[model samples]
Target: MLDSFSFFNIIEQFIIGYFLTINTVYLALVVGALIYVRKQMLHPSVVKADALFKTELFKSISILVPAYNEADNIVESVESLLKLEYPEYHIIVVNDGSTDDTLQRLIEHFNLTETDIYFEEQIEHEQIRTIYRSPDTAMLTVIDKKNGGKADALNAGINIADTDLVCSIDADSILEQNVLKKLIQTFIEHKNTIAAGGVVRVINGCEIENREIDKIHVPKNFWARLQSAEYIRAFLFGRVGWDYFKSLLIVSGAFGIFDRQAVIKVGGYLTNTVGEDIELIVRLHSYHLRNNEDYQIRFLPEPICWTEVPTDYKSLRNQRNRWHRGLADSLWRHKYMLFNPSYKHIGMFVMPFFLIFELLGPIVNILSYIYLIVVISLPTYFNLTFILLFLAVSIIYGMVLSLIAILAEEIVFKTYDDFKDIAILSLFSFLENLGYRQIHAWWQFKGLIDFFKGKKSWGKMVRKGFKE
Candidate 1:
């Protein structure tokens, strides 16, 4: 048998090999984005043009909200929708037969009246009990249906969506005033763009007045604050870098707009998977690839939605578990696209990276930790270079991503006002790598194990409720 040093060396080599391999690709993408953004900043596209919000050329969108047992959030959520600044848009609220007062609240709040409106049921779903509309509020429509999942509810909403584009948002989400205008501007500029995803910000511990976030204050609780840093790094640095490579795999479900015809052509949302958003995007890309059609899925760096993050550990764990299962389900379902040359960048890099890193990274991480502890326990076995390299690549690299996100926020939307919050965020950036990252890795591992065990569980988060 090999000596302890030899065993540690082998584990270290494996970790470094994979880490460098992934980071090399990420670095290349990041460098390309630096160049692209330089040009973009110099020449403001329609996506950046402030005047586009006032333009008439922006396309109308159908906002589809899938709600279940969200009575606490429905009224305020709809009220926030009424405050949106878009010139033309309609809201389709699908009540997925909540056991609570969700349907009653919506009915009373909107002064809803039954209307014989025509709808095309392109996709099958649970039966709809009734459709209600308020003559005073031309932009709002409610569909009361049986207890279907989020995906099913979305399909129900899509059938009644008369607009050219559909924007899927959660009931607990609040959109920034100009999010729609900016998103549509990109669709207009990039004629072949099939879908666009905007940034999602954490609303926990934020100062809220009039149902809008006026300031972004990092939560006092360690978990909540850690997530604040986590979101920034994930989106601003990680996602933007991936978008630079044109290899973005997932458009977050919190807020995303899709071409109505494209979504319909691809058979709409798949209710089987927990991650309907990512699955639908994969299907869209797969459909285009099969037909040899040229299309693009885009990302806008602006924060479009504010959502409450889980303040407690249990809630956070459940959310992470759901996300992990969703990732696994999406990847497995679209396993056909993996390494397929026909899909180009998506198949070559994005899918493979997710399969190895995003989906399986947790297992590798847990194993590495075990090996590291073993090495540290036996002094003769330790490789200092191995430990240092791990710290540099994973820990330091994470901090760099957070720093980039901070700069992005400062450059585009200045949300944080207090210098204390800034300093706290900077400190949390380093602290998160120590513990929170491992928790996330473990969550993904649990998700993987749960997948294999044939155990299905929905993550039900007890919301602090929506603020109006």
Candidate 2:
């Protein structure tokens, strides 16, 4: 019933429709995020930690670090944790069988001695090699165990945690001094809060002095600069908007605070998927909703964590690949939640958006681009007005959203002091959409293919040690 011309027209329209629709969603999120962030800015005071200690809502916290071959930045990461401004919190560093000198470095730095600290094996993980405690500091403890994945390491840490909350952090991540105080506020205010995700800003450009972030500047490296803008878009608007919609599905593994009991109740992190972060959040939602429990998972718009983003193409490719594979793996594992009425917005809106736009977007975009190139090269009877409209809608529209995200960051946080930083971000916002987007899409597609081929290994990510 469809002719060749009609079929091509439909394909072209679909391409435009896909990008247009996703960007439209992004635009809505940006608006919501702006409204909420601006409102929060008016109330500049953060909750005082001393006052919270007297309240019943106050919960002791265990900062969980899951490390594997993080010799370069482990010491600095630990030092950062030692400096956080929170009351009644202990730091638990889980050394997940590092073949490198990761274990030796911690011992030398912290004077860690082996201890027989027993913990119940509530959640399954690889065998624990030994437990160590720092005689120098009362708050620091180390758990050396057989090589388990990140998820398994976190579960082990959760089991060892004697506190009411567990704050999972990457060994390379640095939390702000007041991050815990700010993150814990959600739980303190809303008694039903189970988990809260904080913003992860790129530390590549920022100046690190004396093992602390001293000055903020846009990254000089082109790749890092592009990612700086991407992070702004993803966090400032993307997650915040979803949070406003009450369908926040992802909390970055880099820095997130969770109730210890709630995590255990959901059966701990799943070691089976590389996307442990997303899967855990989705699982928490499914578990709470099914049980008819009142709970809230939040995304705090304030930039609370600063971590490195890959500046090189190879490392960037690996990160993006792993992320896509994780997305596919997580969605497939929770297929039962897709469009199910009982799951609420997670099933009705979030899951479907993830499956269609977030999961399959790379494939659709690549195929559509190939078609566009072929059709343009032919110089045939395609409508010129339609082609122009497609370019504007798909390409320019996304660039606008990126700029809006960058400007929003400027207005809300004022992290980048100089106006030129905003200018540079604005320029990269346009540039990234041109070629970088294509390459990123290809990497994500490869990840999806890797998922189908049953690849489970986390791709290698080389860390460029921060200069203190």
Candidate 3:
């Protein structure tokens, strides 16, 4: 019964509604951070490292790494942390009852000797068998504890962190040497800043020597290349924009720095949620606004952490599913924040955008595609009408974001040099919209289903190893 104009109108409405509802806030954030970046482009923190090493100005931080049977990269990960350029910090590695030789590897590498370190049992966690410290290297402390999830492991680390700040990194990820310095500067420069998240880059194809990224190269595997494109789109466009509006909802646990007291005040990390990083940030903002306290959480455009992307499809799917479930769980658990005026920016903008575009985005997208195909099958149909329109809209938006991310890198970090990489990246960005985007949508959709079914297992990642 619907006419062509009416049918097109429905599609138009969906597109316009999406733009006005989510993209506006996103654009606002992009513009805001761009302006901030342009303004502070010349600031010394943008380049220099020694300035960030001042003990009086820099905040003391404790780095927490929770390992679960990660014998492959445990020692290298710790060694990378030990070599960071920060002035004052402590490393706390939680051995979460690994069946592998994870404990022995650390002991042999770090020459760890057991110590009678007493920690206040502030947060409940599985019992710790022993705590060891490298007597020769004053900054290292390792906790041999029973198997608890990442959240519980982090909580144990938080209890023993005798510092003003805490930074959490994934067990297998490698951080840029200057990551802590840049993150800590934010806390020092901005008095109200509670947490700071840094950009994470793909290291799968990059030449990495001594646990640090030495060169940038696109992965030979298609999935890894797609992920590299995804990361560029995500960090540069998504996060930068979110932070600009002061409505950032999630800080990636890959490399995030937080105020110790603020995290502790909110009762540390939640053991129940897979997306504990996001939940804690949301709760922190909720408490701040509810109690009328001023605070800020920000992200830096600089690449602060380099992590391996899954080369094969299976591992990538698991990672995406876990991430999607995290989004769903965090959103559903904090559903009260949606449109609640008290939480202000987070309640009004961040929560709603996440629910609509991120949490339910998979279903909506899949349904829309299905509806388009059905419409095409009609006898007197407009072939290529929806197809062309969708391509025009998606490509324009996608390319713009990629370009911005590239621009951000060009202006700030300039990590990649080869002009050919830019062309390859550009092609990858377009290719991502064709099929990879839909695949991710399906992964997220599956995650939503698993979440409803009460799935809580941290899906394991099978690695081919990041050898470039």
Best-fitting candidate, measured by lDDT? 2
lDDT (C-alpha, whole model) for all candidates: 0.81, 0.89, 0.80
Q: Ten consecutive residues with minimal summed lDDT in candidate 2?
A: 44-53
lDDT of 1 by residue, 147-261 (tens): 8799999999988999889999999888887778767777877888889887788877777678777677888778889998888767665666677778777888888999998
Q: What tens-digit string does per-residue lDDT give for candidate 2 at 1-468?
A: 999899888887788888889888989998888887877777542644446655755789999999999999899999988998777899999999998999899999999999988788888999899999988888999999998899999999999999988999999888888888777888887889999998998888788877889998888989999999998899989999998888899999999999999999889999989999999999999999999999999998874798888888899999999999999998999999999999988898899999999999999989978877777777676567667877888788989889888887887788888889889999999988999998999999999999999999887888887766
* Superposed Cα deviation of residue 449, candidate 1 (Å): 0.6
The better-scoring model by lDDT among 1 and 3 is: 1
Q: Against the true structure, candidate 3 has what lDDT?
A: 0.80
TM-score of 1: 0.94
In the range 1-468, model 3's lDDT, one tens digit per residue, is 998878766875685456444545556666776776665567757354455454367778999999988888888888888898877899999999989899999999889999997778777888899999997888999999999889899999999999999999988799888777766777887889999898888877778787767788777678888888888768866787777767787789888998888988989888888888888888888889999998999987764688777877888888888888888888888888899988887888678878888888788778767766766786666556666666555545656666666666655656678777777777888788778888888999999999999998768788655453
How many clashes in each candidate? 0, 0, 0
lDDT of 1: 0.81
* Candidate 2: stretches off by over 4 Å: 48-57
Residue 11, model 2, lDDT: 82
How many residue-pair clashes does candidate 3 contain? 0
